[model samples]
Target: MKRELVRNREVGIKSGRSASYYFALWSISAKLVMDFFVPARDLNFFVFNGLLVALFLLLRPRLYLGRRGVALFVVASTFFAALALKDGGNSIIFKIASLPVLVVVFFSIGRGLSEAAVKRLFKILFVEFIVCFLLNYVLSVATGLIRSREFWNFEHANLLGSYVLVMLVPTSYLLYQLSNSKGRIIGFVLVLMAYLSTSTGAFLLSLSVFFKAKNLAFKNIMIILLSIIFVIIAGLALLSIADPMTYDKIAAPFKLINSGGWDRLVGEARNGGGITYLAADQQGSFTWRAYAYLVYGFFIAGETWDRFIFGNGVGGYEIVWGGAMPHNDFILILTDFGFLFFIVWVSFCGWLLVKVWREYPQWFAVVVAFIFRLLCENNIYSYYVASIGCVIFSLIFGAITRASRERGAVRAQASRAVA
Candidate 1:
């Protein structure tokens, strides 16, 4: 028994140390790559998921598969039934094949994280943003590689901008919690940088942060001002629509709302034909991507109402969507798997968010960043997104579990003393 206790202590120490190192590395590396350079497609996907797989292997045994596992099994069984009834590659068989691997990775990492590690990870992330932003500015001037809007065009700039906004949330929260005035100022500056980037999603996320801040009266005033500004912009846009030629040279800042301006932009693209045109043609300016996935999900749910009650098998979206993965993570599960999987997935996320909010209300800022990104990008199912999500989840859950265990121990001791 003594030997076993000693071994357990050693294991615990090792786990804590390893978790801290990995967390720090991930935080820094993610910021650096996203900010300075255009992420390579394959590399981007692989790094995110690869880190998750590594985390899972490092932190093993305390797995929490939740209802997702059971749902996957049911979906697999249904797929097998379908296979027995018919014959083709359309069999549910292919869908079930990927579930085991995903479960193993997600649960393993989820069980590994601790609150202290998460706090440290956030610190590393903050430093990374500052460093990367400065470096990007320098590189742009020296090499002129990233100066033109053309270079940062399309999904790359949009995604990177979203990342900056998302990182700002946790960084800002951490700064507020640090009790250092200088640190808070630095965090505030980072927030300013994110705002100035002018990524539409980032701008919206910043607005979310402003509203969620501790001062309710101030938030209300800000909201009123924002509404007035929007109204003014709308009126200008209406005028522009009525007199396209007169407004053409006026260059309205609210060009997004002007159909005439939009037509001109689209026409220019059709006549000139480049990446900008392709981007403009994308439905609803990329927001439509989520709706597309949602529509796809409804179609799947309609077809597999019975089979998907549990799930259509885990990771089934990869097969169902084929080359084009669903742009919405929520829809990915709901449509490809079923209502059961969707409920479980959403419940788990909701629980995590609530817990984070309860313990560290400031972290909600980070959550805003993530949600804004989710609106425009489907990072939830993407390998990197899943990995980061799992790590963050693990850290939050670990903190909650550890705190509960400590409280329980203290209560037990007090009861024994009274006895």
Candidate 2:
């Protein structure tokens, strides 16, 4: 592996110099808005996984995996393929097939993706964000109404939220690294957009960009004042509705908060309550998600031994659950890939988490946000989600590794001069 790394370095195959690298980045970024224009989900699948297949055959980037890594990959892929044969659909099959290609591409990128490349990727995303925001606003004004959850340029509200999250975290981290004041301003715009999109998770995570602001006191005051005003306006709007029963829906979340939190939720699940009480209008999103976790848990527990060990296969969750998905990525993995593959998945993610902690601690918050998104959303099958995330973090790993080596060399030179 070391020899392979050295060989790549000797050949000077920089990521920025490669056309395929840019194509990968562009395809990833383009997927964010492609849904708005095309509205065909399969196109996204093709543009992303198809490109990975092409890259793997053409570029043939080295895997850069250790023995353990290879073992984990082979095991996981075998199970994924097996499950696909048993119960998986084309989406799962293609997604599974793309795993090896993703491995090669991410590994090649993990070797290095230049800062210039990173900047270009985010710049494209930022421009798209601005354009989408403006278009949504103009359309809303012209229509004289905005939906409770605006989809912006995407086909779904949550997809817009996902895109915002993908953009907000890493871009904020990069801006903060440069001590750019402009980040806060841009973050405020994104925060507002998130709120308008009605995605609570994205709205909260977008605030991280302002966490280290120099004028924290002033920002807090302004934020509080704005929030209060927004609440008042929203309350008035609700009150204007002739439906007096709206209060019951408005108070649903408060009821959940006052109820016993985890204990009650788990207890309900154990009692085979299902999600009858946690259904849409009865409770908030958190309570609904809690029920979802328990439902997936019971399903996994009830699986036959063979299915339990190897999983029902990719897309298994929807197939078994009557087209319902486990929105939580961790649960999705357990249910789709089964118990054995989940172990490997956790190990790989743990290794990556440790690497980030050691090499680029500054991006820890961004990683946390990404993890939160994974927990709250179904992302394993989405090509853009995988590409945007892995590419950015790979670049981070490369940047930090190179800088550390350079610093070590400088320290060695200083010590030699002293001697």
Candidate 3:
């Protein structure tokens, strides 16, 4: 009777743990799909903020800032936040609050997640992301809501790119770690999907998946070549679907090469005339982005000392620039947090980069992809990108840290046996 009672207790404990685990996963997964329901350009801030609060209360994870150095960071960030409040003040307090909330949540994931759990989360997320993407595209086309073939049922085209990039980059590292045939196939599909999204930044960053060291080996090289071939075919297929004139315009370069129009091609390249004419919508065009960057850069350079170091205060940029983000993470950080806090942020990211690069190259790739994406998109505050990012990084880093400790202990045992 005692044995049976003990067995029941064990089963109950396991079931409770699983319930908690799945709840955590569901909370994070819900962020990715939540915005799809809302038709506006803005995020679902209410739901996102509520979910974060609920997770914090349920998990109650301790915030471990790791060493005295982080104290300075905390102080700097607090100072900036105060400055923000004193200045113009941001309407969205969650933007500022989400950072520390994500930090605490990272500890929660780190404590509970194993390698298998991380992989399971990735698989669930990947499947859902792909399915939703297809549905969004189909629905957009059928409903005649298309904007330059890039926009979909999601928020924006760039956001769509960001979504896929988030999934593709991390999974690239995961696939590299596994090196299974099926995993490689999935990786290729992700690459193609990124290409189809037409978010140039996301597609470019997603290529980091193929940067695995051993992929240069002959067998892996063949796989990459095949993937490239498929990418070309897919691009052509998409253009053809857009209608005949558009298809011919896209394929004109190849036809020009066949006709040996080298002079014409050279002249067009020199003048930046040919493909530049085929740019996306006005907002997605390179000129618009370059102008935005210049304006932000000039503002940062010309700001007063106090404003530069302490920032114009929370929603200062939005107020000054007609409610548009800086669109660059570094600029957003520098402008919002000031130079002092920006230094701390850079230092923290640099430390993580070096740590992961030395100990875990797979995670390193994902981190690089993330940093690269930040160059074009300021998504650190968003629930979809930042929240999901915290879960992934925490799980991978935690599992690897435990594995490293286990390996060190095993080595010590072997050495003692030899003695």
C-alpha lDDT of all candidate models, in order: 0.51, 0.63, 0.63
Which stretches of candidate 3 lie above 4 Å from their native place? 1-20, 39-44, 48-84, 87-89, 149-153, 177-179, 214-284, 319-324, 381-383
**Cα lDDT tens digits for candidate 2, 55-132:** 667665444566876786787677556656665445656555555546545655545444555555556667776786
The residue ranges of model 2 lying beyond 4 angstroms of the native Cα positions read 1-25, 49-79, 110-112, 132-155, 211-254, 257-282, 319-321, 409-419
- The window of 10 residues in a row where model 3 has the poorest summed lDDT is 278-287
Pick by TM-score: 2 or 3, better one: 3
lDDT of 3 by residue, 1-419 (tens): 99996676446334434333564567756766775545542456667667767876775534444565377557745764665457533444445555555555555454444455556666777787778777777777777766556455555677777777767544764685565886777787788778767676677677767666432357865886698789868866976786544455445545545566545435544443443443232223443444456667767877899989877656667744566676788888888768887887799889988876667655665687788778778776555556566655665555466557768899999999999
- Deviation of model 3 at 15, angstroms: 12
Cα-lDDT of candidate 2 = 0.63
> Tens digit of lDDT per residue, candidate 1, span 1-419?
99996677456544554443464355437625653565564454456456545654664335545587668656655654654344344533332333345444333433444445445656766677677766665655576645553223224444445555655545554655566776556556665665445344554455444333443356765885697589657844874787443343233323443434454444443333322332332323342343344446455745745866755554555555444555566766665557876787677668857765666554555664575466455554333334444344444444445556667899999999999
**Model 3 TM-score?**
0.72
Deviating ranges (above 4 Å) for candidate 1: 1-118, 132-155, 165-173, 196-198, 206-365, 404-419
